[model samples]
Target: MAKDYSLMEDSNRSSNRSIHDISDPSRRIVLRGGLGMAIGRLLAPVAAGSAGCASGARGDGPLLGFSSVPVSTADKVVVPEGYIAQVIAAWGEPVGLYGETPAFKFDGSNSAAEQEAQMGMHHDGMHFYAQDGSRSGLLVMNHEYADDGLLHADGMKTWTAEKVRKSQAAHGVSVIEVEQQGDDGWQVVRPSPWARRITACTPMSFGGPAAGHALLRTAADPAGRRPLGTLSNCGSGITPWGTYLTCEENFSSYFNGPEKPSPHERRWGLRKGGAGCRWHEFDERFDATRHPNEPNRFGWIVEIDPFDPGSTPVKRTALGRATHEGATVAVTRDGRAVVYMGEDARFEYIYKFVSREKIKPRGLRENAQLLDHGTLYVARFDADGRGRWIALGHGQGPLTAENGFADQGEVLVKTRQASDLLGATKMDRPEWIAVGPDGWVYCTLTNNSNRGTQGEGVDAANPRRNNTTGHILRWKEEGDVDGTRFRWTHFVLAGDPANERVEAQGNIKGDAFGCPDGLWADGRGVLWVQTDMSPSAMGKGDLTRLGNNAMLAADPHTGEIRRFLVGPVGCEVTGATGTPDGRTLFVNIQHPGERPSGRSDPEQPGRYSNWPDARAGGRPRSATVVIRKADGGPIGT
Candidate 1:
């Protein structure tokens, strides 16, 4: 999740078609009747529907029974000889909600009201709800931005307003309440009432159809339906009526713009001395030239009920916003809901929404406005493996009002300019979106060194042209999740299939990884995968043989891929979850002493990783970790 590239907003000039033009050799022998029988007819109906998937394995032989764990330029956390791990919840700890649990003072002096009761900073995408079931409940997560040199003390030299309210109380979302403690394992149920946090100032509201539009009016929420917080809170989702969705990535690097910045704030990268989190020098409402609609109220998809700790977080915005990178709900077999998103950067796209209403067996108060009424769609992919979703509604076609889209809340606050005027299919940076319990959906695309550069070439599902090792894109929808047509492939392509540079040689069949950011697919479908690889590109070049950043599991019915965990030095094996009896898994790890100039030198704060408190000079927090199976069996077995 470190591919900001100064918010590379796609300027898309239409002309779609490129999934390598289906490798044209007559559409590659009629749409790949080759590449291993086109990935065995795209995973043989997900391994012949694995006996109706989802039940935590065991009647299996090889769904990845834990063995693979190699690549490790260590610093700690490796797991896989009957796994163990530990460290439950980290960053500035103590998310005891109002009972105040503070206590995480490892030198960065912790206070902006004790980091708003702690725990926020770099841990991305999460979700593990349960209740009294799987040992306990509610983990929630996604505090996706804030490194500010190990979050201040003398770090940004002395920035004021209390280091901009402790870096806006370390950017949004946390929740807490965990349990499972028989063998002294998962803990954190601190002042539990579903121990909330939700920061970046936490006030939130805004629901669908661009909430109160007028480009989300703001001179301090002019009825633009609130929106005071939730910044780059990356990848997350849970909802089958339970709640918690998160998303909202690279929130235009937290405002500041306006030295001639308007083309919708330069298509959302804002600019004019921002992106460094000075929080527009002590929050003048982040000064987008004096709060110009506060960065259009943050790239959305909020939701959040976590057992209603006084619920409010909303921002659904009909699921349109870009830079989202998460949001994977699914339901529709006639219940409606759908979701599925992704739009990390470099030539963005890939979206979904569907929910016009239907999910009701009495949950979250009759599905409280079920995602504020949906129908977003944006994909396009066709070169013949098929795809097409389009829609972005407002007068349909060119999203009219003469192409400026005057309704549907300005086509959802210009969702990437209405998917670049509905031409879509521009990816290679689309972060997370899971699904697969045989319904197949997946997506990661996490690498794009500006694909083949100059105007970003190389396509056909982003066919590596400088892609720096990254792949994984599945699909299926031809009928269910409110189908709009689908059928795609390439489930794995991440690097080091012995690279000598054949686009960084990837086709991973065993253990070789690079940049395939956090993804999920649990409930027995395996497919964990996590990886981010960017403490200034770890060891350098083709990601220096993919070491540190790790977490893998994949088995979408025998496509086998393992490497169950590795992560420490300058970390980022991002948010994963478990424990609906999958016997505990958690994961997270984020900025462990992140240097290579991505901030942190608070006077040698554990150089490049002191992970989970390696003591001696402290300061490298961004925790979570948990993992189990020291015979308590279940995770990836």
Candidate 2:
């Protein structure tokens, strides 16, 4: 969700539905025989061992065994030569969870209650979990925002209330624990009782159907069922009962409103002077014209239970909130629970939800109300390569109340105007959604520079136009994950197939990297990906021959792709996970020397990257590396 907190603007005026508004544009790229023969007949029955794939991609032979790691404007961290990379719980470290454990003071002087026990700031979407088998676990992650010029200590000068509570205690979620120390590698189990730190001022609750609606009350939450935290925490998910979802992407650039805002604050882009993290001049709930339902208690998803560090962190709201960027659960073969999500903006839409019971063999107190009862839906993608989902249910079809949806909690709080009055499909910025050991699903579209310019053109599930390097989109649903029909394609179109400007040359089959953002898939079918490309467009122009931000792995049945890791100079390789005997992995990197106004000047904090403390004027934190395998086996093998 970076790209300087996603910029915003395009408030979906609907009329979307574009793949050239189809009507035999050559049956839109030859119907089902095109996105490369429908991704080789939907990954050729999961590379032929079908039946719901994922037995770790069935004894694979070359599902990426390493070796590829080149394009790296090196300020540090590039792996693949038997692999090693270390770093760990970076940004302001400590995270020993509560009380003392302080220690992260390279002059930013900690505070805000020691930046709420440290380790928060940048590090987007992560997971880990394990326990002892992988030698320890828990990790968690997502501190998606906060650079107030490297958080405090004279950065946003004179800004007070302890620099808005240390930039809302460096925005939310961290969890920690880690372990694997026998060879002296992954540490941080410091005070571990499963560590913690769910910040932005923690305490959170709210559950199903827009919990206590009235546009989420809030005169300091008179009854919006409590939601005093979790903001901007981007892309993350892990549940099957284990818990820890996070999400909330650009929470309307931390709000500000009223200069003529309301149309529900310009359809969630708020502004009137925000998107600059002024914390509304000192957090009166980020002052959206005086707590306008406190930015409807933040674009939701929350969840968290990373083995209960004294729980309390819910915000589910039947999963509808927009701007989310990550959720990815997938279950429904009767075990109910679907999820999926995406809305990272720029023409938005691509949600999921499903649930309504099932999933029982108990865990987080018997599935904690399975995401508070669901149904959401919203995808569309049609010009032939099929896709459907629709149901943003409230009085269905155009959501009734003669349009402004009067119930299901204002149709999940105007979930992008009930997905533009149920017509949906206007993507190109979707970001992270995984699900595939081969049962498809994928996602990631992270690009969309106002695709085909302001008048909004191109489509066929976003067939590049001004899309500036993006693409991944998979799909397959028609029967499982509570099917509402599905078919999609295009699993790779990221950049450099010898580009010159054919819509930023993509269709990459290996290595080339571009915006893709973080995605995962692993229990073997590989497909990792990552890349974000933004510190003001990295080395410059068409991503200057793609030099930094990388992660790549992919093999989803031979569409190949490789480049494993490479992040540093102005970072953003973004959150990945591993370890359940997959050896190690972890990843993250985010905002490293982020500039081009996404903060970091505090008198030139190492001017552009001093990654993992390359010193000389350090401060570029946002870490998490780890990666292993120097014969410890597993990981991309």
Query: For model 1, how does the per-residue alpha-carbon lDDT over 1-637 read when each residue is reduced to its tens digit?
Result: 2433333454444555434434222222112121111111212322212111244433547667778888888898888898788897888888877668878888888778988888888888887777798898888888888877777767888788988888877878888888887878879877887787878888878877788888888877787998888888888877666777888877776777887887767776677776666678777888888778778788888888888888888888988877787887666655666777888876678888888877776678888888898798988886667787888899988888887888998888888887777777777778887775445677888787766664555554444767777787777777666778887877777888666777677767678888888887666667688888777777778888787888888776656688888888878888887766677888888887688655777888788778777889787888888888888888878
Clash number for candidate 2: 2
Q: Provide the lDDT at 261 for model 2.
A: 85
TM per prediction:
0.33, 0.33
* Candidate 1, position 243, lDDT: 78
Q: After superposition, how far is residue 588 of candidate 2 from its true place, in Å?
A: 7.4
TM-score of 2: 0.33
| Cα lDDT listed for each candidate | 0.75, 0.75
- In candidate 2, which residue pairs clash? 111-114, 218-221
Model 1 lDDT at residue 270: 75
